[model samples]
Target: MIWSSASAGPTNTLLPAGGCTLLPRATMYAPRMLAAVAQESQQRCRFCTRARAPRSQSAGWREVRRSISSNASPAWHHTRSISTSHLPRAPLAPAEIAPSKRVIFSGIQPTGVPQLGNYLGALQNWVKLQDSQRAQDEMYLSIVGLHALTVPQKAAQLRQEKWDMLAAILAIGIHPDKTVVFFQEDMPQHLELAWILACCTSMGKLNRMTTWKGKLAALQSASESGEATITSSEASSLNLGLFSYPVLQAADILLYKATHVPVGEDQVQHLELARDLAETFNRHHATGQRYFAPPAHLITPTKRVLSLRDATQKMSKSSTDINSRILLTDEPEAIRKKLKGAVTDSERRISFDPEARRGVSNLLRICAALDESRDAHGWAELVNERGGGSGMLKSVTGDVVLAKLEGVQKEIKRIKGDKAYLEKVARDGAARARERAERTMREVREMVGF
Candidate 1:
């Protein structure tokens, strides 16, 4: 959760990350605490207004306690009495809507620096969609800090990572005005709504999920490979946070009532689970109306980006080897260095057969993704016709990749330097995101009897 500078006690004083202070006991909230602090905080500091904006609501402890006891609790309890007429009409089913009318929501975890796979696979597509979408199409870009907590992290590093992720997003051309880009931690509604959906979800469905199983397998493989020091017993002790992360993921989408989610092939299962939960929720609480849209997948063409070091696996930040993935922040020289060392087969001719030649195909895909004019197949054919082998392909790929990312890298540096601008973007984006989320949540409270 995003921290606040206004500390109630020594225990409450959270370390700063990005520009904001992390709140104390931020992740843990009993119903009483939810009613007391979260509600009060949102109401008081609703927006990070411009320099000329009026005074914000007081964050004083007594004020919060008094407000909770008087207004917040009663208001919450009053949801039971909310008339059906007070609620807005639910939109048409997924099949009935056009792309323009749909709300698109997607997120990336702020766990670490995003790599080349992250840029090409997800972030780049996000910007393209935003720019091309109809004015009616609403989009949200989330720096999902909560999801990062599923794995362990140092608080200081996580905070810094959170800011760094946002900067990368902005640098890559995600405008706050065109899209809502915010920290997932800022909104308590995500967790609150997750609990409600969790009740409707089955443990069996969660068990069948491939994501947790994949994590387990990866950890087991790491243990065997000596890449990570995790033991079998340690793997067995995987926390509930990691296990039930899909529920939180579901909440991230459903909270925004997102109609479309742009995802890679690996994430298709999670998206499907989101649809199931929405259907189940509608059946139980929606009362013949589907309150949450069953989010459809807006699968991109170049979805699966493999690791530079290991073409067999998707590129990842978890790998101990830095060369496994090309980070968005890498300098041009670093990019050249990594690409020069990228693994490829001995076959002199660069071909696009992924099954027989994954490394060459991966490089071809990277070049293809960077240059929108040519598809992967077309690029592969061109490279083969040019009589250039893997060496030539790697050199060309490096140049094209470096050229594409030049502006983004520069912008990232600038954004990092301007701490105030970073804070403003986060604050403003959080304000806008919370506004939309609260609307959905109010209906949720009414339907679920609070």
Candidate 2:
């Protein structure tokens, strides 16, 4: 889950690494006091479970609550609900569409690899959600090529990147059949819905968004010299597409009428924006009749996996240093080399102190995330078993990362080899998405008298 940098709290307590549990969605954000806050000021705030949007009648909220009560609760696993939404679009049967089995929507930009943070923070959670799932309640995972264009790109290179990322995601076990997988740019309706939602959105709201602020910060930092200072004018040199991108994101959610959005904590603000827009539009056009229900955040509970070489920074595609990040397609040898070369504190002890030993602690965090059993206890034992040294922790963590990545690499190779099949899948998935998006957009347009 992504939130304010200062606001991030312990995503999981290491009980043992052997087998961590799939926590109930609610528990992900249960008030665990943070040492990061002043001792006297410490308050119980939902850490990892932060959502970008709000909806009182959100189907995702009910599903997530029920998910926790059932999966982690031995007493209530068998209970079922019939109907949760008063909206016309609400899912009909709640019993069969249990949280574990409910439809889910998550997408990523095909802007090459997002570094270790993306993999550990979001992708791993995707695997868990996909694997633990029971029935085939709809799951659509998109490689959003369209989202990529807010920045510049080469057409040929971008196309190849799109295909490559799809294979990579697939290799990571996103079964195209079990989940509807597609390229977002392939659908005309994504843009269509984006336009409809944009009408409801204000320029003022878009201007206040943080995405452009981040870009501006990155630009300023890169250009900073001992004597140079950047101005807001320099920042505003960037254009509208980047600023208004969230409107498109809102459209993505509304187009799917996605009850649940599997979002990292960072995206909660954006999701909240989406919710606000959805509610505003729904209310504005209700004509004393309700339309779309608000979307709910399916907060993912994976640690914000940091850089292997730099604990201070999140692993990112933008990192200038080669060793700072790990790609999903990294070969076992490359993974080993990267881990072996990782930055660790001079201290010998292997512990989870993010404050004192950022580097070593970062490795430990990654190990915990990739822990085969997802058990913190098993991970702790493994760390202790590695002789309680930083080197051993790095070694063990490297092994675990390699092991987890092995299948992903193999699947990527296989999928990449079949370009024709991949294109066919993308085409089919796009068609389906466009159909749904168009349906929603048409309704939205009529509601707005467009």
Candidate 3:
């Protein structure tokens, strides 16, 4: 029953039943024109008895014309006879349309061996998504070496860290067959697209990000600790890469046309910038078509493991106190000793009050993550029932953690030994990623008149 504009003059409108209704040019785009035609057709004709059903192909055009002519008013006689063969194809039925596959993209920096916070906060969720996603879903995981370059690094150490990160990703149960794991530095298109997006991004927007400010604060603290005061000139000489890091991040997501991005709570602001830049490109650069879809946030679980030395801050690799975080590759003895020395309150009883007893609650949270059968409160109750206090809680948490990491550590060691296999995996992943990126860039180049 819907009316669509035809290729003919403005006075003519095409109906789904292979006929043209003549109307005034002013009413061509009006809904009332459709309503009046529908009302008249229903009262006059028998062919439109079931208004919602598909038109039967068996009813020839001559028969339809005769039916309308016999029943329609004098005004209806002006309807033009058109061949059914000349009609536009009917819209597909709802059940016949195929659903779209999800395109997912996420990245992590290659700074060092992933710690407990990294595993629980991001990597574990990635493994869960890989196992649960549909067969046709596409996933891309990148070791963002470019992002790491925003800070100072040793050449040999950066190379080793990249390989270590790749090993950890495989060790954590993210299958190469299910996910495309590659290094971000391998793709030049990432940088090229980054430059393009950077031109569209505003400096004021980048200034609002908190990560760069944190980096500057860390830099100032480091300089002061070394007994060197940073003058205004030295501060002004900060690297541009550190300030505009989010622009590159936005390019990474937009280049892939990702529909979903997995990110931690702290990184949500960067993802929001990606969405905004996508919208800006579609509104101005796209030629009457939305080429990029704004990616949605797939927030990971709230497994924010805090530092053992300072409960107020997140666990970080940059912490000078090695005891503050547990690396994934730590030996069983090291794991036990670190947990034993973890900072907690003077109260003997175990509790899960994060605001008051952050250190104790962090231990309980880790235990809950390792053993999903119980939560932090449940673990606290069990430890209290054992009547051993903080010592017993640490012991219980250590045992579960050791058991969980045993397999991962062994796998990482095995993977690291075979350098050839890792190279092959990287090459295959880069090839696949390049093919998709090239296709997107081709269309983008043409759209921007390159």
Candidate 4:
């Protein structure tokens, strides 16, 4: 029998014998070659008869003896020529193989203009991920307009916000070529896959989720405070899209077969839901074949920017007061005015205490974000040594914030003015995203018996 040796594993060794060679591997098929030889060989002369024919029996006998010494098994021992073509080729060792490409997908809503919190917490890190990723890996940053539609929006203003957000993303140095920056509503596959995932999702799990509850609670608070007209009983008026958007978020991650999803602490639960849905689909449809990759969360470093007005709460777009949050596109005058009016404790000392002195702590945190070299505690110490009160604290914070946002504002203005460039970026990003999504969908359809 012909023995193909390339299929041997690294741990496998060749066993040398008087008349044959044996390969030892994890799962060796076809019993020991010697055993096969003893069972198949009718007589000792058979080995001699299969040897290369010589002019005389004396020369032929010598050839058989040489063949046996060299451990060359004859191909016609059982009246059939053994072909090595059927042997399975072994794959390369792990160290010799190329590393698999990592697919990263993350998105943000264009609910309103992105603020300082959005930049430091999410957008800035996105550019870092894109710049540091290897060529084989892909990073996607989407403008999720669909998610924004969970609530009401004016058509003209929504369109403007989408373009404005895109310009802001570009201004922050996220390369369009390296990172896919598309509008989520532009891709129909996202919704298509969302419906499929929703079918597999459990109602109990959805009920257990707290995001919807938190949103309603915020709405109720707004109503009580006269910031909104909706009453507590009007919670039922909330749209189905708002309640079930988590499933769509899952679809977004799975559609691109993303391996990593960068999210904040608040969004970790949503990423977990995405992971569960992906695993559920794979279990039901793909079985042993994992067509969907359960994505992992690349949680952003915790950097919570509190409201300028009330440091107890986070900076949010829903806040009716524009000064509560600093917008990325805010002019120097506006930034100076907002920071000047920011609340601080009555204490003469500059200190960082979230529980006791929230407003002061918020300013310190903002300063820390703008200047990474100094943390909040370090800044607090520096301000204390300088004998600065709230005025000194506000001045220092405003100067740092303005210095950092100046280039960003200029870049955003330049990018927003280029309408054709913005359109091209959106179109190109959508095409690339669609290409990746279609590939995953095709495999999913086949596995689901579509």
Per-candidate Cα lDDT values, in order, are: 0.71, 0.64, 0.73, 0.72
Best by TM-score: 3
Q: Candidate 1 lDDT, tens digit per residue, 1-450?
A: 110000011111121222222222211111123323343233322222222111143232221222434443332211111122223322222232243476788888885557888887778878888898787878888888888777678999999988998898889999999999999999999999999989988898888888778777878798789877986556655889877888888899889978777766666677767767876777678753446656666645555678889999888888888888899888888888898888897777667888988888899888888887887788777777778687788888887898898898899999899999999999999999999999999999999997
**Alpha-carbon error at 116 in model 2, in Å?**
3.7
* Residue ranges of candidate 3 with Cα displaced over 4 Å: 1-99, 214-228, 231-237
Arranged by TM-score, best first:
3, 4, 1, 2
Which scores higher on lDDT, 2 or 3?
3
Error of 2 at 282 (Å): 1.1
Kindly list the per-residue Cα lDDT of model 4 for residues 1-450, writing each as its tens digit: 000001112121122222322222212222112222122222343423433222242221211111243475533322121222134423321122122777788888885558988887777788878887997988887899898877777999999998998999999899898899999999999998999999999887776668777877878798789978875446654778878888998898889877777777666677767766865776567652345655666644656788899787788788899999899988889998999889897787888887888899999988998898899998888788778789888888988899898898899999999999999999999999999888888887888789
Alpha-carbon deviation at 9 in model 1, angstroms: 52
What TM-score number comes out for model 1? 0.74
Ranking by lDDT: 3, 4, 1, 2
Q: On residues 83-131, what C-alpha lDDT tens digit does candidate 2 reach at each position?
A: 1122232211112122333557788888564456777777777877778
Instruction: Write model 3 residue lDDT over 224-314, tens digit each, in one string.
Output: 7997778765576478987988889888887887777877767767876886676566545663234675566664475889998888988
* Per-candidate count of clashing residue pairs (backbone under 3 Å): 3, 20, 0, 0
What's the C-alpha lDDT at position 214 in model 2? 84
